[model samples]
Target chain A: MTISTTPVPEPVVADRPPEPVRRPARHARLREWWLGAALVLPALALAVAFKLVPLGRGVATSLESSSGFDGTSFAGADNYVRMFDDPVVRSSFRNALLVVATLPVWVVLPLVLAVLIHQQAPGWKFFRAVYFIPYTVAPIVVGIMFRQILAPDGPINALLRRVGLEPLAIEWLNGRYSALFSLVAVALWSFFGLGVMTYLAGLATIPGETLEAAYLDGAGFWRRLFHVVVPMLRPTVAYWSVLCASGVLIWLFPLIYALTQGGPGDATMLPEYLVFLTTFQFLDRGYGSAIGIALFVFVAVLSIFSVRHMFTEGTRKPR
Target chain B: MNRRTAARLGRYLLTFALVVVAVAAVYPLLFTVVSSLKTQAGFAEDPLGLPAGITLDNYLEAFRRMDMPRLLLNSLITTVGGLVLSVLAALLVAYAVTKLRFRGGKLVFLLIIVTLTIPSQAIIYPLYQTVLDLGMSGEYQGLILAYAAFGLPLGTYQLAGYFQQVPDELIEAARVDGAGHFTILFRLLAPIATPALAALAIFNFVWMWNDLLLPLVIMGGSDSKTLMVGVSLLSGQYDVSVPLVSAGLIVALLPVLVIYLVFQRQLVSGALAGSGK
Candidate 1:
């Protein structure tokens, strides 16, 4: 399958007739196979030892009960059952759902910005460069910075007070809904730059004549955006949507850790964060593994489309 | 309004909104840098105000309290080590799968790409146990290996795509000259693959440096904490000075900020490569 996909060099095919050199070619091919295996062995070993092996063990660990310094014993599905009744686990998944529900905003906001920038909006270059600055800062740093900024007596509230919005100057990270909202907003802020970059790459694949035709036909910006640009960007949009959806579950650990630590009354608890707390902090390896496995399953279901898309996309011949 | 005038107004509003978002994006970091230089008392009196008197006390204190040098060293070692290992693995695997075209190359490529969907969180605990079982817990190699393992998928995916573009004739020519795969890969293809490798390196560097989870979990209360872990711990401390924490945040952010400024193009392109179809 792999050999058929890649075109053999034309000169080799042209210069060397098939039957005459078949014997030496077979020898060379065997050598090539060995060389490929040798090159790939170390990486394959690392992946298996670290990733594949642990993945299976992680599932196994999830099914067992262990506590304190005691050795493990099989608990069957007790941990999974307990997860359903655990308020923290329940809310963590609930918050994860809430964050995932914000996927449209995550996808569309950067996309719109990318479109505007793609149109060469005034200062687009500067906007392109400056907008990515937040993404460069580590999420933990972003979280820590915002923790102070969102403190009740912090700059955000102070500015609100200065602007005569005293009532609106409430605790940003201390309230239930507000903390979750703040997290979503902050995560979006830190990530939208990459979204924009992705969309721009997608946009670059689009030919100019199509947009030019739309312009010449008197389509306005919004019309051109929705009509001409967006349809062409479905793959990119799907890509980002899948990325953000999974990201909301997996990638927000640092932000949650630094900003709210699953926050004011479990408002910001995510399953991934809860897994960390449960496994590392609370020492409930069985339950934490359960949550981890559950999160992994959810992410896998969500990622199937994108994974397939990316697989074909990655292997597709470069244009 | 006339269509032309309305279009002009829309353009103005669009630019204005873009500027506003740009400021929103950059303002927090500027706020942190400025506030880091302010006296604590000054910060308390007016948290939003520009500093009354610039002071380096917070930075100095942060450096001392956070053991800045040690954290920096730990972060440098892991980031560089992870970057080198992952990029090399990706480069070699990409070359093998793309150029070598041996049997099962497709399966090897597929296995690596599929791992992209597996989030580190899912495997965190077991991965931790594996590291501990190997007796590499709290060691540099443990975290480095984990980073390299996670990083391999994306790097290989991107580099394989890049490698596919290199015509087969190049490798064939080298082979005819009596070059083996290793020599051709390192001496020949590696240079050709430099742009892709550099972009992958920058991308992985930023991620591995900024990452807190692997280091935090694997290092596990060890003194050899990465800078992000150190900053996180600093924030977690009770009665922590906001300014001091701000300084620590800046300290953690400085390397990434410098990398961003210097390799802005590569960084942006790397991001593009990450998501590019």
Candidate 2:
């Protein structure tokens, strides 16, 4: 846990009185090790039993095919090959790519909002607290809430009609592109609060003098935000990006379930939900495991860069 | 177009935009609460306007249909059980790795942290199979254990950071009194670490209460569905009124809202703790 980035003063070995308790020290050290192992046992057991073992079994499951009454047999890479050729699988990955493409909005919108709040915009405290309210509501609740609001005869369209914009009042979660867009937008709405809080935490680390100096030199809000704030927040931005990039794939299942349910024609079918359908609904356990492994590998690779940045950022001594 | 006026104008514009965003953030929940109070006919008549008359019928109907009391009990049991188990395990592991400094402590910590990157969806089927094999499906322990396992990584990571800050001198002094690890940890370290434990508990509670997928897949067929799964099922029913569904959502969301209102600071800090550092 102590992945310290800075050097520490080493203990002076010669200064310590040696060996008076050597015989007892050996016994104590052994006891300490034993105690430590015992303490770690529960967490280790839970992790191995639920996470690690299932993960390994998931990989093995992906390689085997099963049929009713025929039992199971090793199918090698058959699922993976079929996955490549399956149009639904291809489209799910395609949708995932499109979601990833929208990562800039996921990253930048909150950064901008956080900057504005950090600058102490009027009513900033209230805005800061209120913005996080949506985040507290469960994704399923948020999805259900939006489902009502986005329905064809929902409040949003009602307002649109009232404003004489009837044509723009199409079903938000029904159209192909619009459904995907709505899904992403709702996810953002529910999550941007955390992103804002993250950037604000990063903003706290930047010295106020830097911002003051930039303003004194005639830099406006945008100038200071870009030149000073964004540069200082690179690690925080990276952390949030990694979270969102992986999160969009894995975390959208509940929302998708309650909102569009892969929509008006697989328009909102992300890989996570697809994995569920293929396994639980379609009973293609092997193929589902294959998709699941692919998703895991994709996420693991995306996480590597951030994991490094996170450790360094986490362990860095604050000035 | 002078400098002073331009600065004033920019500030006003920025404030105006922030106001709009803030409203967008809160309006949906407000809409839900408002709709939940309206009759179905009132909602159908004027979806956006204030209701003509308030009615608790939607709430009552939703309560009956979703079996709110049963869902509430199931959610409470799983969330509390999960929170206690995860926090206790994490505390022990954190204390051992940071304070005891045993062999392989670093590796153990690393393994737990690595699991953070593995999404639960990736191993859903195998995990489901494991639960079924153990004959734990449709039981509270199945979902409780799953929640505890997933909660361990972040909980341990955060607690380890807190435990690392406790000076070795504290432990040394406790040991000088001939106190065992359990005594020192529970009586001394636990009190000092209350804030971190509270934060972890709140985070896990909210997560377990709100989670739908695990409950949906694990206990979906049983009478033990969590509130979230029940609400989700309610939403899926085509004949269910929007107001009724909103009521169900409100019932499910009430606890989270209460926790957020009361422990907003701990919640925010806990979330930030999970944000890498």
Candidate 3:
């Protein structure tokens, strides 16, 4: 160690003259840094202005007690404590968990459909268009349309009634047992297009020769799918899982707010909907902020864990 | 079966299944269109059947209630503004990173990449607060800026990926000719990147046009309320006219439908291409 240190000092002295030449390069590097800064400053400014700065304020707001978005003072985590004791919050969180359970239908169905669609057959373009059309329509429109279809006297019930199945004709949107299912159905209708499209894109990146080789070995569709296509599609599956999981939490607001309004005794209440209620309808910004923060923390933790797991599990080492 | 016959059989079965799925997928929209022209009694009596009488009453009523013309203009303005700004900002950052080997280039790109994992739910509180603080809670600029920030990362990442496909030799030749980076990028690269840009523009436009939450949160009380928000309000207010509300929704969504039909290919491909998540 002493010998290494002595020689390192001699080299440091010998290499000192290039420091002057390296200075302009350093300046040039600084200029490059400025250029990179210049390029990225707009996005950074926007992110801070729209995301981080508001996060700070939101945290502050959550800690304070307020009445009708006014007269707020530091209330600490009382709001959080209240969330545990509040039956509505507990029920809503439970409902959200229930809604999340429906994710496999979105996550898994799309992969299967994508594989089916990726055959690139005679009408591949048409099939792709067909699958993607639903996404082009607004979610609100889809929700309204489903609301009509799922109404007490809507087509679905009318069909059941005509079949002399009165029990099957139960009110779709209002019943506590049925409301969550109705919301899930609406979600499937609204988002399945995007999911299918994403999967199709992922499937496109998979080299065909590998699947063909598996096929030549007399591997059946199931075998090829399980052994070859699935392993190849791991990245897409992981990406969509993270995206869809986050979406299961965030995007439910649209359908919930649109269709149920967390109604029929809060059977379909979700955290996002609850946040909206607390902040806007109830005018308790402080409590609203707490709920918002809690929701964020919950989602962030889940997303990080899932993403980390996906990267570790699905990541393929380069040969 | 041999390869040719096997491929042929696979095509047939897949196409058949797809046709069934397509009809099922399109049935609701087709049903809506048919129902929109029917009387309330007709709709209730036979929801799936063709209208007993093709009446324009629903549409006219919807137009009146929704202020369809103004709503259309507002949606267009916000969407177009969002599309242009998002594409431009994303292009600058993407081009700078993928085309130039500047210092901290990888770091900046990596930061944007990391943000892709950050769920929108985690950031909304802060974003909402920021919009409130900037006194832009009810303004078009606020919504546009928010969309730009939200859309930028994905847009930049996709465009940067596309930019990587632009041969470096072309850029090097331009550099040798003493063209400034901006000149080569704008004059040379932009033309080559038109297809990707078009796809990005269409995708961003559709997303902004359809977004309910941002406009709902930021522009609720003001005239800045978008078509989605308008339709949502209509949905919530029960005992209000249902036909008129449906009509309003139909009218609000017509432009998007038209645009989708026009750029159907680009829209589909763009969605598939940019759908990294």
Scored by lDDT, the top model is: 1
Q: Score the docking of each candidate (DockQ).
A: 0.50, 0.46, 0.29
lDDT tens digits, residue span B146-250, model 3: 888778767776677667766565565555445666666666777666667778887788789998888888787678778888888778664244455566667
In terms of TM-score, how similar is model 1 to the real structure?
0.93
Q: Give the per-residue lDDT of model 1 (tens digit) for A1-319.
A: 1222222233233354233312347777898798899878877877887888888998899899997679999999999999889999889989999998999899889988998887789989899988878888899999989988888888788889989999999888889899999999999999999899888878776777875576446666677777877888888888889989988998899999988899898999999899999998899898888899999899988887776875676577656
Model 3 agreement with the true structure over A1-319: per-residue lDDT tens digits: 0111111111112322232212346665676566667877887676666656666777888888886736768898888898899999899888878877877778877776777767555677777777777778888788877787787877788779889998999888898879988888778877787788777877766677865575556667667777887788887777787677777778778778778888888988888888878877888888888888888776776667544543332222222
Indicate the worst ten consecutive residues by lDDT in candidate 2 chain B.
Answer: B268-277
Q: In terms of TM-score, which candidate is stronger, 2 or 3?
A: 2
Cα lDDT, model 3, residue A297: 75
Q: Which stretches of candidate 1 lie over 4 Å from their true place?
A: A1-24, A215-217, B269-277
Candidate ranking under TM-score, highest first, comes to 1, 2, 3
Per-model TM-score versus the true fold:
0.93, 0.92, 0.87
Tell me the tens digit of each residue's lDDT in model 1 across B67-118: 8999999999988988888888888788888888589988998888777767
